[model samples]
Target: MANPKRYTDDCALGPFSTKSQKTLSYIFSPTLWTPLLFLLMAAPPSPSSVSAELRTSGEEAVPTEVIGTLGGFMTLPLNISVGTEIEHVAWNGPQKTLALASPAGAVIILDKSYQSRLSISSQSYSLNISKLTPKDEGLYRAQINRKNSNITIEERFVLHIYEQLQKPRVTVKHTMSESTSCNLTLVCSVERAEKSVLYSWTWVDTHSFKSFESSTLTISWMPCDPDVAYTCTAKNPVSQSTSSPIHAQQFCADLRASRGRTVGETVVGTLGESVTLSLTVPVSRDIEKVVWMFNTSIISKDWREPAIAGPLMKSKEPGKDRVWVSDQDYTLKISQLKMEDTGPYNAYLCLNTPRLTSTQHFTLRVYRRLKKPEITWIPGPSDDSICRVTLMCSVEDSGDDVTYRWTFLQKGAVASQEGSLLNVSWRSSEYHPNFTCTAMNPISNSSWQFLSGNICPGPSRSMKHWIILFLITVVLLCFGFSGWCIWKQKRQCSAPAFNSSQVEAPADLSGQDASSSEERQFIHSVLLCTETPTGGTTTATE
Candidate 1:
């Protein structure tokens, strides 16, 4: 006999016996069948088999939804392997069949609705639809047939087309008065929005950016910063759009409080010095509490009690040890003043009888002390009618805020000038000169002096002395030259000039006295004849 067909739950054929009727009855017994039924009922359904069963049923399978922007391309993915022996492929749309392919691989378009806009990829069997419109949003089915087989694989896709989102608009809903603290509400909305569109709010500050999911945001405190920006964004799965940045200054302009009136004196402090900031409230109001603040930090707070009590002082990290509150007036005293301490300080006094507050603002300025200035003369000295001297005054290790002033003293007359450089002139015997350069800042001042007699002595007198000495030296040289010339003439006269044709012999002093006198006269005559036409010699002498 033919072997009984194997029995399976999925098979629709009649059950076949694996053994004799007696064994089948034993297996079907209550005790055995009950446990089997319980186990079968407890077991989870296989995903693959359930999906296959769903597909095999005539009921339409759920399609995968794809979102796409209008006027854009949409891709419908089909995960199916095209066998080598594929006979034909067909795609069905909501209204009619879209495309069909023959066994010879020639594709034909049955519906000309998307004639040029539809394309198919043979590798992935995915459908590409271009230039999508709102009308294109519908169910699309793809069917693939095997060669000489009745079995066909199918896939369904659901398309959702949407237009690009426009820019959103932000509006302020409510704003309170600027005189008091109040909440501010803002609303963000779009002209047109899809069902899936979501709204988000973003708060942008100088330091950070924060995001919120709600369309409306309420701020408890009035925003004082001009650099902060608020924006709204509308987004969907397919498109996203952002609203224009709204500055806090623009939206919260009416909510800003007026600047507090300045009531205390301006406090000036030197760098690394200690300074006290004081505030006094009017006696008309009952002082219930007092608070002192520096920048954004609280320095002290005093709450009203049954009797007089000291203020509770608090300090932040940087100013902890350096700052404290005094017990007398609740004034704030800061030691070791730093550059960061130069700002506005506030004192708040709360009154109980009238329920009013009085605020005093103090402007604190910290300055560095000026160093001693130095005066130096620039090179290029002049001694024409008046002596012009250029002096540069400067201070070492001085800040940019320091200014220089020059005080010129001439014969007890003082002339003041302000600058880093000074140009002064004086004539001979005109004035005794002295200069003092002062370097000053808001907090301190220092000076340096220069004596003209010490730095630049009497130039005219010195020049005169030099000229006189030069003239004396020239005269001495001329005298020495003249004397030397005269001596040379005398020496020449002592020697006798003889003609080449006549030879002269030496004469004895005792026997030839007359001859010697005659010879001397001849020599003197020769020397006189040898004198130049310039008359350098007045007379000839032996």
Candidate 2:
């Protein structure tokens, strides 16, 4: 009886007073008990008591790929930290296991093929393979695990081992078309590399560049197209090599050749300009060296001629750094050409890679462009009876190859003359003439029409002089007419005006009869007064 409430709490499932459970039915309801039972059964244990979970998947992770050179050593990277506790690690090659290591035990390599070459680092646990070969290229797997755990992390790698790519060799095959054109098939390949190597080509010519991919490249051109140079590149995954630029020209030469050389070439040069020789001898060989000569004399920057021109062949032309020989071909270039540079030039080429010898010979002609011709005339004295004038047509720069032509126009007809001089003569009554001068050279020409005064005295000049006189006379006549008009105006202004209506008779005659003698006398006097020169109107008796 003394501890009834405490006893009832001990008997209840919850620590609540009877007043807290306002509805007794709800306090012991089955719906509340069902949910509480299900929640306890559905949930697992808390984090403090959980265990490590092991995961394994196949081909889920993307593999890392790397390049390796043949006969070179490469290590498979281990991404684990330096402080990572490594209980064990294993490496699997393309076909079998290669290496295995344990922190607590000695490293074991199961594969006999890689036993001598395989190695493992204890600190980083990275596996290194030495003396790599082509057969070693394939997928590799690394298995890594921590201490006291069955969990394993795998890393896959793809090894692409390749040999060192050396300088490639290019072989050329020639084909001819029905016309003058031809085709060249150039095959580029490396001898020391694997079959996985790729090839590409580069073709260079005047003002153009072209490229192609493949071990085989086909090139062709017309007779008018310029010679093109080509080079090839061979590359593998780990190494690259490029061939030397092809130096011979016979494969693309449009001109016929004899003994691998083209002869009888010509090149033109303008005065104060540069000139390059045209020598296209396509060949399938490597250029060793090129020697250029001018007029059977060797051409170099410092040229020396022999004292006595007997049997020894040497260059006599003064090079003075003016000549440049192409490294890729047998062509020669001369800068700032002079008039005396007009001569024959010979080029000798020596090539290897199947061994070849070629030559190129050409002539260079230097010319000065013609300047505009000018016509100047010397007029004779006006008092001379015979009209004679000298016309001279000349140019600033004259050359031996230059020529002159003259065209003369007289009256309504035209005439042509040669030479730079013209002696013109015409009488005073003859027609004046106009003329033109043209200067020409082998390369260019210039013409100038004479625009000066009449070359000789004739009716045209006389007519011009007469026109001047006529204009002067007309001006004088205009001045005389203007003066006469001014004089007439002044005479009118000085004279007096006259009116006849106001004339009257004298007062003495006013009383006289209309027929009186005095009236008649006054009338006569008034008329007489009016006749007076400088007087007011005369008064008369009315």
Candidate 3:
């Protein structure tokens, strides 16, 4: 076992009590003095003082201290002998040769070939162990056989060695998140690394971009356009690493639009017929989006993704000064027009200006056809008489303008003025004929009545006389009855014959009878004359 004392411990003097000192003195008094005398007798002549000498070994050597005494004065010798043997050994002149053994049992020969006079007795010694490596890790033993005394000592040395770690590596990759429009993340990591690592991140921060750093390297980013270089560097105490060039890219979605067009007014046809509606709109200039709508409902809006055969065709190009657009005007041909279709129609135009748009409206009208009139004869005394007969004419709804004409289809064959009724008097024409009245307008016309029905014959001479006689008799009877009634009323109220005494007329009974007979004879002759007819035909003009 090596010495248990630590290198940092302080060297202490030996513990000695008075009683133990006396015992040690008695033991060493005579018998031990002989060995001491021998040691002294064999000792070389001592010099005044010895200078310090450094030992030649490698850096593995340890510090050493030597002591020597001489000539009863205890002077350290300058010239001395040092070797593995601490017994009686002699030194020749000034030159010194020291022999020692390493802890690993190797013989080492140390020669002091050059020297002057060694003076200092106590030499503070250190070995040059820097050139000596760890494989010589053992005690090195050295002894000094000096002129005064002999001594030997050994030193133990321990060696340690170490090696540094290697540098780390960095790998970078780019990725994005759910929000595609957001900034991307550039993640850099130390791949297959053995040591603890650190990282830093930097990006091309233009007007809109930024950068950050993490342990190895992780990065969160935002949207910014950059035209400069973005670089990332990773470093350790051992080595530094940089990344390869990364190219950044971007993309966006295409813009979509709606077609701007409108349908206009319609033309109303008559009942049970169709009407044509013309839609008016300007053309499309560029590659336009077309959406077809009815009222507010969207019929079809995607012209690019047409459900049927493509609904949108190319419009005329806008060349030079002339402006060209798609044919947005459409004529809607409506079949089977109804009465309800006559009111109004609207066309909505969604045109594309720079920003603002426009719309339009229109109207339609329908009307009914006119109907002809009807005429009927009023039955009266003239129904069968040869005199004029009245006929009534009326028209159905003929709007504002209706023309009426009464035509005598008989021998007259003349058209009369327009009225509700027309009178025709029968005359002894060459032949009997038919009469008709026509009611006409621009749209339509119709005859009032045909004369195809039974005809009314003219009155005979006998019939005329009978009529006159009947009239005369009716007048006479009426007058007589009136006179009788007056006379009876007077008689009932007062005297029967007015008490004939009051009425004194010229006794004229026979005169009155004669006047009455004369008047009766005159009426009879007038009646007979009226009954006889003249030979020539006579037509009354009124």
Best by lDDT: 1
Candidates ranked, most accurate by lDDT first: 1, 2, 3
lDDT of 2: 0.63
The lDDT of each candidate is: 0.64, 0.63, 0.38
Best prediction by TM-score: 1
- Give the range of the ten consecutive residues with the poorest summed lDDT in model 2: 1-10
| TM-score of candidate 1 to 2 decimals | 0.45
Which lDDT tens digits does candidate 2 get at residues 8-112? Answer: 111121111222233334424787668746765897634311221111232234456667778998887766755557778878887777778998657898888
Clashes of each: 0, 14, 18
Give the runs in model 2 whose Cα sits over 4 Å from its true position: 1-55, 178-180, 221-227, 252-542
Per-residue lDDT of candidate 3, residues 1-542 (tens digit): 11222232122111212323344454357976788678657874233111212221222234322211111111212233343223322212112333333333343434443122222222322232322222322222223332333222223222221112233233444454553222334555556443434566565555555455663434443222222344555554334565644323221100001112223553435544555555455655331233222222222222243311111221133222111112444333334444443443333333345432233444445434545577676543444324455667777655434567776646642333446566555643324446666776544577755563455553345678889999999999999999999897655545414433422332334455444565445434433433436654422121
**How do these models rank on TM-score, best leading?**
1, 2, 3
Per-prediction RMSD in angstroms? 17.0, 27.8, 37.9
Q: What is the Cα root-mean-square deviation between model 2 and the actual structure?
A: 27.8
Instruction: Pull out the clashing pairs in model 1.
Output: none
| lDDT for predicted candidate 1 compared with the true structure | 0.64
